[model samples]
Target: MTSQSGLTRRLSDADEIVPDSEYVSESELRHGSDQVVRETSRSLHDNDTDAIMQMFTEKEFETSDLLEICGPFLLSDTAYNVMYMSPGIINMIPDTSGAASLPVTSLFHPDDRPILTETLSAQTHDGSIMARLKLKDCSYAWSNITIRQGNKNIHRALYISNTDELYRSYITQKKSIATLEQKAADLTRQLEAVNKELEAFSYSVSHDMRAPIRIINGYAHILETDYCADMGEECRRLFDIILTNTGQMNQMIEAVLGLSRISQKELFITDTDMPALVKAVTDEQLSAVDNSDKINIETGNIISTRCDSVLIKCVWKHLISNALKFTAQEATPHITIGSERKGDKVVYYIKDNGIGFDMQYAEKLFGIFQRLHKRTAYPGQGAGLATVKRIVMKHGGNIWAEAGTGMGATFYFSLPVTDQ
Candidate 1:
């Protein structure tokens, strides 16, 4: 039997290995020892020492030769003792050695010892196992070990090959996933902070800013009510201009606040009937405006969709009211609303016969305070389209318009189809 120190020194030097059967080359390792053992055992019974002599003769081969031809492997008895180790195995298992004394388990990582032990302990003794095997440098390499039983003097043969590259790739993949998860968490925190700032801005616009405008408008109204009759024609005209401008400013301020609210509002999504929602908004707008009986309203198969009912209603109110306002000057104002299926989405459009702007400026139509017509000609702060655009985008939809001067404008929006 060899001592632990002796085994370590021998292993470090890359010495001989033990195999379960007669001398077999590296290429023959997978073939198992059944045929070799049977032939060698028969030869031994006939009093021949040729096989034994050949094993020692092959052992004289250089370690480099073994490394090139064979990977690290070991031969052990049924009790798992270190018997014969190849020159390749010797260079890998540097810490222990003994003739039928040291267990091959000593060369395995502590974490992998139980796995190998359980594999060998199984009823089917011949099986494959994966574990980290110790190297001469005291590190470990991932190795696949296959143990096959022998019927001769040797009990089992252990064939081991390194799979370190595959193991390292798995480790790298885990690290990359962790990094992505951390980045996602950071982005969520940043979004939350931005939303909080928006909330505060909305509050300021609703209260801090509107209060002074309200006071100015109130005083202007009082002056008109009490002093308009006493003023000269020029003075009265100037006062009227002041009152009108102040009122327009208030409307602009309200539009800005509405835009802010749209951004901050959380969506309450649900299945809503498109025709019902549109008709309701249209009725409300018509009842509030003049010539309710004059504007010709038309429709098509506007399909039902999933969306935030309140926000979607706001969208309809803006579009319908916009159509009615622009078409008010026409002798026969016509408004049409309809939808059509386009692939996986439902495209809804509102068109009106009115004094439309040129297509070249279409891109600016949805921007806040961007207006092609003078406020004197067509009154609005130009935030309605911007608000509508925002609401549509939040629903994961798109909005676009097409028109020419003196012709009608058609505003189209698409929503993802949920029913289908």
Candidate 2:
């Protein structure tokens, strides 16, 4: 578009940006505050007074606006003048470097000064003169120095820049991060110790008690069969009762074993074929005396899991068996086993249409030897769920039950994604 004359210019290509060297001064330049950069740059050249004024020069120096944002500033007029000074300028003045200069050097620990001097000198030589210095008061600090070329410039003329506040804040932040990391590590160690203890305790209960129980059952059977006729009727009846006690004791012992092993044994993690394990557990239950026709098993998606196959199958058996046993009087017991992916975890659920417990008893359900029903009503030592609890805990997972009295029970367990 043209101005007053109504002449028009067509737009072609977009303008490109280049560094200062390529945009060299040509004819005449402007300090045209009224004009846009593109218009001004097109006219700028060496002859322009405004352009010379804008050029940075060695004689004048000032702290950069950037430096002000990072920290506080202390400036001598000399430092102010030399800020934009060309590199390699030394600013030291022997007298302004501060009193007791030689004496201050003497105060440095004999072993420390050489290392400090070498390091400070190296920094100066390499174009960076910021240094952390230890003061006479035992407080340490950081200071930035600009060395400008001058007749009076020497180490003695130097005055240090104070940065204790910024340094202190940096140190504090570093220390806080270190403290949190250490606390996290300590907590991890404590948790690991507690878990080890729980595992050991579970193992001891399972392996140690089962043997004595088996012995008691064995001897009771031998006495009943071998000494029946030789014994009086009263004695025979007592033996028979002992035999019954042994049988119940065996059931209790096995329950305890199941619970303990579930919690204690190290898991043999493998990629399990879920359909196969479910079928195996179901077949085992069918083999149990008088159970097949009484129960109907409902199956769903049997997802594969990286888990202890044997122990997991045992968990299934105990839950299913419990469902069947509790609903022994029901015309037909219905049991459902299924799985789903919940976020990064696999959730497996077992639901049973049986003598479900009151919801208030849920917390006590997984506790060893804790039972809601009487011994004769639902005969169990209440070890099965406890075993389930341990197994879940071992996998860095959790188990819980949802139920209402006589409405049926559902147990759900979760395994972490890592196990998948």
Candidate 3:
């Protein structure tokens, strides 16, 4: 009932036409048809085109003229039977002659057929969906299909645009990210194995060295006790030096064994009352030494945290003992122990007015057997701070110090806040 000119005007007035740059040439479409059958075999006659136009007129919809200017598109009934297909869409079909009877689902990729079937069965289909459509060459291209419903849902028009290039690029990037993640995991495992082997080697060497050191110390003690009175003063003094050097060596070996044990120990994490722990360490240190009256120790508010009790206790013992030993020379010795909130972590510090070393040597303070002062002056194997650093790091924390020559020192450590 609709005139040919009227249908052309209606389609030209429609707003969703594909740009001219996107339109497929008739020659290109014929090239695809040549691989199957001649283009004339699939072409519609003048009256045939008029009858398809009349079908749209009865439904009060006009869309056939759009087939010339739009991108690959198709019209289908609720039953998914192809009513009309554009030349560009015909180029995508391997056999255009059989297109009219072909089910629309056959054009979609196998993995995407279920999605198209679901949309056709929906009460209404008016939005857009993305799907992979099968091409004439048997390959698939990503497409954006915009669905437009006609009056009374007699038919639906699908405007499809190709996005194959972009989809392939995204797939390539995803595979690259997965490969990088796998490489990182492999490197982490290798590092862990190397660290375990080093820890075992150190433990074995320390364990074996203890016996020889013990023998030397025992023999030297015996010679001093039985032969000191008969020997000259210089000989006795030299013998005393041997005993002293052997004692220091034994202590260093013990420190190494202790360090290895801490590395291998399993953590027993718990909610610890930090204030009580600090108080207990301070009390025990003061009780063991007779200088409690000379030293002024102050403790401020320390928040609770979750940590391993035994390991953390060792940390407190080392830090507190170091503070006491360094501040012993001060006429008015003072020590402060407290903690404060720093963002999402709690920073605890021990301040002492002691004989601090230069700030330039701070990096060496936590290395085993590394000392800034003479052994006779400090009377330590320089393992206390190293042990403290290991314990703090095991708890997922960090330790650092600030000091100047002859000035006071402050050691701070941070622990994440696990409780409100």
lDDT of 2 by residue, 306-386 (tens): 888877787788877787787776778888989998987889888988878899878998888899889888777778778
What shift in Å separates residue 378 of candidate 1 from its native position after superposition?
1.6
RMSD of each: 11.9, 18.6, 9.9
What are the models' TM-scores? 0.63, 0.51, 0.66
Query: Which model, 2 or 3, shows the larger lDDT?
Result: 3
- Model 1: per-residue Cα lDDT over 1-420, one tens digit each: 112223222333343433323344444544553454454455455545565456547874454453444555688887777787876677655656534377767788999888777777672556788888776667677788888788773578887754335345645775898999899999999998998888888788778887887788788878877867577889878877887877777788788888888887888889998899999999899999888888899987888899998998988999999999999999889999999989989899999999888999999999999998887888878898999999999989999999999998999999887652
Scored against the true structure, residue 220 in model 2 reaches a CA lDDT of: 78
Ranking by lDDT: 1, 3, 2
Q: Which ten residues in a row have the lowest lDDT in candidate 1?
A: 1-10
Query: What lDDT score belongs to each candidate, Candidate 1 first?
Result: 0.77, 0.59, 0.76
Model 2 Cα RMSD, 1 decimal: 18.6
Once model 2 is optimally superposed onto the true structure by TM-score, how far is the C-alpha of residue 204 displaced, in angstroms?
A: 7.7
- Among these predictions, the greatest TM-score belongs to 3
TM-score of 1: 0.63
Question: Candidates sorted by TM-score, descending order?
Answer: 3, 1, 2
Q: 206-276, model 3: which lDDT tens digit per residue?
A: 76777787788888888888867688889888988888888888888788878878887777899998989
Model 1 CA lDDT for position 40? 47
Residue 239, candidate 3: how far off, in angstroms?
A: 2.8
Candidate 3 off by > 4 Å: 1-145, 148-153, 157-170, 218-229
